[model samples]
Target: MPAKRWNELSPRTRKLVVVGATVDAVLRIAALVDLARRPAAEVRGSKRRWVLAVTLLNSVGVVPIAYFLRGRRPQPA
Candidate 1:
């Protein structure tokens, strides 16, 4: 099957793609910032591994969400 060029995509499709990409980027940035500020011991796994996964893996915001949900331990009030 032939791949469609950017111009070939419908306006709605293009808007959705752009919105998705923006959300992904925002989530990744938030995750990275949190990782950087939090201590290694506060994280569930090796901070290095989480950094690599969050930065490299393209999970459509899933990876970042996982990092926030499962990677870090709860902080004391």
Candidate 2:
């Protein structure tokens, strides 16, 4: 299958692509920083799995959103 070139996209599509990419970048960065600051055991799902999900699942920022929405915060002793 042939990949569609960037120039082939319509103007509106190009704009949307740029905006979506920006959002994904911001969300991914936020997720990474949050995960880094959290204790391994503090993460709701396994720490390793969460990290992988946040970094690996880049489309529409689903994993990153899940981290923020679903990740459990640590309780202070």
Q: What's the lDDT for all of these models?
A: 0.95, 0.83
Q: Please list all clashing residue pairs in model 1, or write none if there are none.
A: none
Model 2 regions more than 4 Å off: 1-3, 74-77
lDDT: which candidate is best? 1
Deviation (Å) of 50 in candidate 2: 0.8
lDDT by residue (1-77, candidate 1, tens digit) is: 99999999999999999999999999999999999999998999998899899899989999999999999999878
Cα RMSD, each candidate = 0.8, 2.4
Query: On residues 1-77, what C-alpha lDDT tens digit does candidate 2 reach at each position?
Result: 79779999899999999999999999989988988888877778787888788778756988888788888665678
Query: Which lDDT value does model 1 have at 41?
Result: 83
TM-score of 2: 0.81
lDDT of 2: 0.83
Best by the TM-score measure: 1
Relative to the unseen true structure, what is the C-alpha lDDT of residue 45 in candidate 1, on a scale of 0 to 100?
93
Provide the TM-score for each candidate, comma-separated: 0.95, 0.81
